[model samples]
Target: MKPRFPIPLLVPLLLSVALAADDDFSFDFITHGPMLGEVTDSTVKVWARSQRPGEYAVRYGTDPASLDQVSAPLKTTIEHDNTGWVTLTGLKPETTYHYQVYHDTLPTGPAGGFRTLPNAEEHREPEHNPRGLFNFSFQFGSCANQNPNHGIGPSLPTHATMRRTLPGKALFSIMNGDFIYEEHRTLPVTNWLSQVGLTPGESPEIVKLAPSVVGLWENYKTYLSRGVNLAAWQRNMPTVFTFDDHELVNDIRGAGTTGFRERRAVFRDIGIRAWEDYAGWACPRATSQGIHFGTAKLEEGSDILTDKDADFSKIDLAQAANLHVHWGTDSAGVDDIRLDAESPANPNAGVYDVLEVLDAHRLRVTPAAVADSTGSYSIGRRSHGKFTVSNCDFFLLDCKTHRQMHDPKEPGKKGLTLLGDRQKAWLLEEMEKSGADFFFVVSSVNFMIPHNGAGGHEFAEGKDEAWTSMLDERERLIDAFDALRKPVFILTADLHNSFAIKITDRVWEFASGPLNSVNHVPKNDEGDRPATGLFRSGPRTCDIRWSSYILPDLERLQRLYPYYCVAQINNVFNMPKELGGTRWVAYPNPQVIFQYFDGRTGAFQYAEAIGTERKP
Candidate 1:
């Protein structure tokens, strides 16, 4: 200033300062690894995503060094809102290939790599696929919360470690649910941002983002950034993900009209957006548009509201006043007033319809909603639409959507329902028609019986009785499997513990412990008897094996009677504090091999000529 520098020199100095400022701007570009899908002899589906939006490209080859040899261009698309995902196809089976994804423009940012699954048909020989051989080795877990103080944040590092340790071997990983803890706003996002050293004012772009979605996106980003271990895993492996309660508001009933419906709707939109962004691509257009209810049957004499009839714009002042008086007010007073004033003879037959015009308008505006009250059930043709993945039929059941009356006297809670009659029929039909070898039923909550508490282990208390009411349906579904006798394995992760249960005519169940949480095995002296009497009699009726790995601290395993193994990883010896974590000990892996068992004696004394392969 004193020297009065030339205008050209001043311009250069300003430009350099601006460049430096831009360079100092801190942002995160977390990547979710390559997930395998649509596997076949010739090709398989490989997908990946990053936090930031940009052109995504994938380069692949058998050799890690020469990934350029089999490089393929990929198109990144938006799913929920901000998460960027890409899928690569036409990969050969049983081949090892390395892949790297780079932003089209921000080339300087991080680029990760992953491998694909083998061709299912290629493993013809026993040697090639040994005993207990699985075509794929996948690691799936759920119930991860964002804990910044722990450094792992919301996502589990052990799963990532397992993926990295396995390297080119892991086919895929499934994040069953609770991918983020956004809905529970007890932990403020601002606090999280502060922990991450992010100033709120610096990133004005995030201000426009929805709180739930922002929380989820931030948690995901934090995992990617803080997950130095997970980054290594993602660079080598891909993950397939699904949402549970935490993804949206916890325990949301999609079709129900509870007070939280509006909040749930918002949560669903934001959750799906965050899911599409952080996870791989999900085509939820059908779900998003509420098209799944097209085939839903209505209960007789029920008021079925439709988008057109219940449209906010359609309600005139009189119609709105009538609705407010009838539905908005208490039901008790209306029944008495209508009985005494309108119909003196029949008190029970209270004001069923406020106005014939409303009913007629409902019929014209929303025929589906009108038909819903008719008691005649409808079953829409089972179509996967966009949510289906090849070789796997995902029955993402709507267990939490409907509210059913519950009885308190039942062993478990009486309110839970596995499926309404219509959904049950559709599910059976789908199962019967399914061509895939494995049917992966993704339920947010546990489908199997709970061991800890009776009365269905209240996840949402009074509002969640519908989930507990379906014991009969659960048994019926199990019976269907017993009748069809097809190979079926159910994956659920709401219990915060990992378990593998073998459900047959004879109850042969095996449960795994939680990867996180406190490890507490029921001591024999504690007298926590087995629920199905499978523990006392022997391993015949059920072979239940439970294990828990509480990182950097403990690991324990317990089998019913003949064998129980427990191992704890403590820093007692000359081991590093970080790697001193313990893992549960067990002789046989808990995977069911479809063997015969003695229900009466609880014994597996006979051997069958069945081809059982281990899951690698």
Candidate 2:
């Protein structure tokens, strides 16, 4: 019966368009989004914002009132504040237009839709790079703390139970990190900034923002003028994101290359400019001070973990002594590098001024070759890339940006990385150029053993940010997935206890958490608290299997619709295991239990597949 998402008529249509007051002059709405970013094969990119400004455009085609196609204007001001980001270009692939969003000729909101990406000859058929069928399904989740007390505002009853279970054209959703909780919107949000007029105790202006300014775009414009569940789940699909570490804080750290560049540009330029001004996210070549300006050399000397591919030079610091190199670049398209240090007096000290959050923005140093002298540092940009959908191919790994703070003079470790040597030689050279029989690795962090320094956020050796605080890049990403014996499967969600763990026995490590934040359950160091599969204290919305990849008819992936659960703890013998792998604890008292439901209704809460090695 999953139907309840009127949210009292979507909270007065998103509060009359974020408290509109154009009075009647038209445009005073859609101050947040129309969202739907990065789609190709003829291009698509709409994402709105214009409660005030003027001229903007994105009319769109495929006819809707003979919608004579458009595209030009885009004037929304505030220097990127009145946000617009238009890009309609040609258009065709899997096609499905019918859009809206104007301010000049009038027509403010309503009338939205999008669909692109499906033209490599409609994702190839007729045996083109053939292999089993699996069409598509990405539907990911992550921490969202819109603070409905502590969380769950845009988690929207599981975004209306994933929009009534992936209905009509649904193959795109990957918000792999804290959507908001924007470091408490950087303090001082006094009396709701006086109900939008300011003065109750005033201090707003995002508390004098700037450290690069990403106050969650003012905390998602006050969580979408007070919640409409992430503008009704990003105006009906087409979402792609990444930003662990509470968007900015609560575990924030991504420096190296001698870090401290103005304190790593304060949170890497206001947390990637508040996630590219609230998810318009397009920073690979990002500049205008947001940062991602590449440059890292030293390969012949080898060692940035060796995802080889270097060019930019100039650092001969005493003829590149101590050797041990490897540093790469190619961000706008992805193939980053870093890790393995030494031979640096200032071998470009190895660029720490990058952001968005690791996959190695920049952090270098790696000498070792003569009794290893200090030689260790792994900062980030090792994220490599890949993202097909319907036929399957999701490889985006770079967990824990760039790290520092160590002490391993040979306790089974030296200078390894979670993925930074040009993302482990671009993930074993893109898994020998995968052909996709079904693969996965969209990690942002999480191999298991939860306790990211728990309420203390450690590193000095307390580690725990996922992947055992860097067990030399987690055993070199588990020997590069046990030498890519194929059979790939490892989707992650920052440990809110989304479940399915066990790191070996063939690699399994599924999870989902904070998908919308504030569920904390992590306490250890003697405090103890982690094991709690299928969680949901408040930021409701759960799953690690989520219909084993959000259905789309794989024989209806064991149906479970109408389910809108809210932290339904079934305690499969106190589920959420991995007690010895490191720290994924949680079954402390689970005595006798085994619960699993296929179809849900009584408030819906059943994604019981706990991190997967299977045994629900």
Candidate 3:
């Protein structure tokens, strides 16, 4: 029997890396992780961070005793905050492999192993069946902040529970979003005083101002080290992460027009860079290149471009920032500033790059002719992406980027965008082309449900952060799913409660976790269909299957408990043989069973099943 690893009460800093005096911040030598990611039939990426620059490698094999295979040594540099990944390849499909990390000659963390996904081709057979069915299971949830002041727990207990309960059964964990929330605003560091390890009432002047990059790095380091349970879970189970607002800043809308363009520009470049170092290296990227673009209104008749709040070309574009720009024509001229790579006038047309950073905010570009007036200036580049597993395609939508400010009155207008035109198109095309048995669309925010009653079930009013504000895009995506006639599971998070809503006969939406975030009371006004309980919430457009929030006295009932949804998928549904029958019959219909469990008591809170019926 495999020995059960004990959960540590306090998260120990990994090993010493670098040290700073002001905040007394330091990174461990083998800091935080030797976690797994990007696991496929024959490949898995092992990611780890170090306090110092050095070459690191991983030893692996099917047996824990022999552990014969060794990966090529990869170097960790201070440039990337001493983080990197070494991918192990030539692995056997559907086989389990054990691994141990090496800091040069010495082994680092505990031994860990994971089972590779089944080969896609293996599902087919000539004798028993021509088309084979793929089967697998995974657990998913989101919104975990290990900060005590946030009213969430000091550590992620749910991950420990998942690691304990699921064991070798779950293929990988899907961290839908909000992996870290400690990196709040940095213009002046709004929430710095409340951060852990800070002196009480530390003078704002004494606190070092961290650039978005450093700030994000510090948060990841702190969260990973402090997240003892999360650390324990990731060592064995790979996690696919997508970003929500908190990953960048609280309630960030990458493409929204309302925020300060300068800050958005800074966050995009820094945040993406930090995310790549910490999370993106292991995940598949969107075809759109994870590019996030937005337009800023230009000053009229003035050569200097300025919005109601910011000056164009003044947003800080970091070194190594890959950015493109398209200057728009007058509003009356109907500027063709759309992100059309085919249009010569469009910056994304691939002609001009951000020439040079004159300073922090000001930039220099060629064809100086137009430091002149314009309607709007569009700027964007590659950002976050998605991944897949087995015959299931996981389209983890880049919700943070490419979102536009929605007009509640004209919700269906072209201007209202959540998954920008490019991403939406990519999704539809991919879904249409995929031969997968199921499609799991992961959105960091609730898809069709509202968080508050302010907009009365449809719009969240001023908050463009949630899908409730992007009703038009929601409908369009739903239509696309309905057309496919496949089993589409829209798994969502960030609302801080678990919910299940049936959008159609073949499509459903499951909002999963808070993992460890503060409690957000579910409300009847959040949606149209209340599941006949205290905290039920679901869209009126469809029936709600179940809502964990609906339990009586929900707020006081289980406030500290974290939650998760484990989903099992199978290609066939079996009908037991009747009393006189000789054998059971198998239907090609793919079925998915979702089990929601509370972390505190390991109690089963709810379960729901859905499947695509095989045609007669």
Candidate 4:
């Protein structure tokens, strides 16, 4: 039996590479590695970060033995938090090549390799191609909590094992979101603060240290940098990213509690930046090349990406510093200018210009309207390009940023939406055009069950909390999707448990992982999904006590609800399967495994997967 390697998360100082880390800090592939971006036969983009400000570049070629070739140096500045991406151009089509990160023209890190995607015009005829059959499978799962959750017991071994050895093979993977848990606005949202090493006061040191309005981003930046799970995966398999609630401060809706849009604005900007800073380069099609990051168009009201819009050339440091709450004001000062401006009389529409002001410090904010003011756009400083795997193509959607809700009391309100106008249109447009053998839609939220809280039968999780909450919008998308009638598989993360829903033979949704958090139980069987962890089985409901650290999913449930049998994985990990070349996550044998569903319905056309598509 091989050992299951659980990645130890980083310390506070490490740029919380996961929310659990900071963004865009690839320095000569120091912490992570040649995370891939767009790929064509002749060109590809690679994203990496400098732990500190410095010069960076990549040396690549078709030959692993001789990678004497090098690209121009990408200088990372402290202003961009030392994150730099490099695009490698001039290469033959459909080829495998090696690359290494270099500092000052000296070898700085391990050499990584990638194969250029097949040309679009080239058909996958075995006679014409050496790459036989051209069949490839990518792995995906979510909800890996790096910080140990003391629920049921000190995090389940099943979840932890999955986190360390997900996809097991070196195939490409997508971390659909909730890669880390920020399930609370402040620290100590759960009772396991001491256990997780998080210090908690009304405002912890982290809280005290973050910028006033957008403090959460800084908080996540610290924690995400520490995520060893994501870092490890990125080092090897090219993992794509998107966000769910935990990436922010848990279920952060478009509307805030104080009736001010500032919370929404601040959280929105923070989430986007956090994604850009840490997860930006996961997909290059959206991040590295475009001036406009998201699917939403400027005319149809898409949210603007700050790094895309932030023009420091127009402002000075003094102004930049003043825009930040922590840098500009006292602890008890005004953190938000939106609340004051949005009032009928104040109508501070452009008084402070949050978008322009936030740009000063490299922070970003989009106006509720006016996403485009400066006419032309530029794709500056891209390292990689669109995310690609050989013979397979996928489109990742950012789910969380543009959710506008309706009054829950009135479910049928006409304009109630989950995916905003621009993004929804883009998804439909892409689906109609793509010709890949398989079509995959990725998100972080679970679209399987109704918007339930604590695993109960509550169909609505507040006003548009989960996708099901928005009645009209989800239905419309479902109708359009059903019409497409292709083999559309949705891969996603977000829930603690594992699930699947077959909307149609054309559409199959598979959800795997809580990774490092509380392994989920059959929904509605347990009392409630706890704030931090899950509840134990019946008779021992709501137990947050830690018995043993190593928990196999089978032992805890007695009867396997999803039946992730032990035959595939024993107590030890990394073992090879009897199938000679393949490996198993649990179950053994070729018996097609189809367990009974928990009878949940209407999750994205009776399938599963909540969603978020983070920028590359």
Each candidate's number of clashing pairs is 34, 46, 9, 56
Deviation from native of the Cα of residue 268 in model 1, angstroms? 4.2
Judged by lDDT against the true structure, how good is candidate 4?
0.44
Cα lDDT computed for each candidate against the true fold: 0.39, 0.46, 0.63, 0.44
Compare candidates 1 and 2 on lDDT and give the better one: 2
lDDT of 1 by residue, 207-316 (tens): 23333334565556655665565556555555555566556555443322222112232233334445555653432222222211111123334544322223333333
lDDT order of candidates, top first:
3, 2, 4, 1
State which candidate has the highest lDDT.
3
TM-scores of all predicted structures: 0.58, 0.30, 0.73, 0.57
Selected candidate, larger lDDT, 1 vs 3:
3
Worst 10 residues of 2 by lDDT: 328-337
Name the runs in model 4 displaced over 4 angstroms: 1-44, 61-66, 91-98, 109-133, 150-170, 183-225, 255-265, 285-393, 406-413, 454-464, 521-616
Candidate 4, TM-score vs. the true structure? 0.57
Best by TM-score: 3
Query: 277-331 in candidate 2: lDDT tens per residue?
Result: 6673521221122222222343434333221222213222221111112121111
Backbone clashes, candidate 3: 9
| Model 2 whole-model lDDT (C-alpha atoms) | 0.46
lDDT of 4 by residue, 1-616 (tens): 6434334534432445353332333323454444665445577667665555677788887677788788877665433345567678877665677787877656765667766544433433333333322323344556555444312222334333433443432245566676555432333323323322334553332223332323333344444355543444454455567767666545555421112233332244334444565665556443222222111113214333344434555543221211111111222112232332332211211211234433432433344433343221111121112243442346676665455544656554577655656557767887777654345667565443343443332224333354545657755765676677555555555545555555544454556554455544433322233322334321222222111122234444332221111101011112244645422122121111212122111011122222211225
Task: Give the residue spans of candidate 2 off by over 4 A.
Answer: 1-27, 32-34, 38-58, 62-91, 94-100, 103-115, 120-239, 252-390, 395-435, 438-440, 446-466, 470-484, 487-616
Task: Mark the regions of model 3 whose C-alpha exceeds 4 Å error after superposition.
Answer: 1-28, 121-123, 184-210, 254-266, 287-380, 383-388, 408-414, 453-461, 524-529, 532-540, 550-558, 572-586
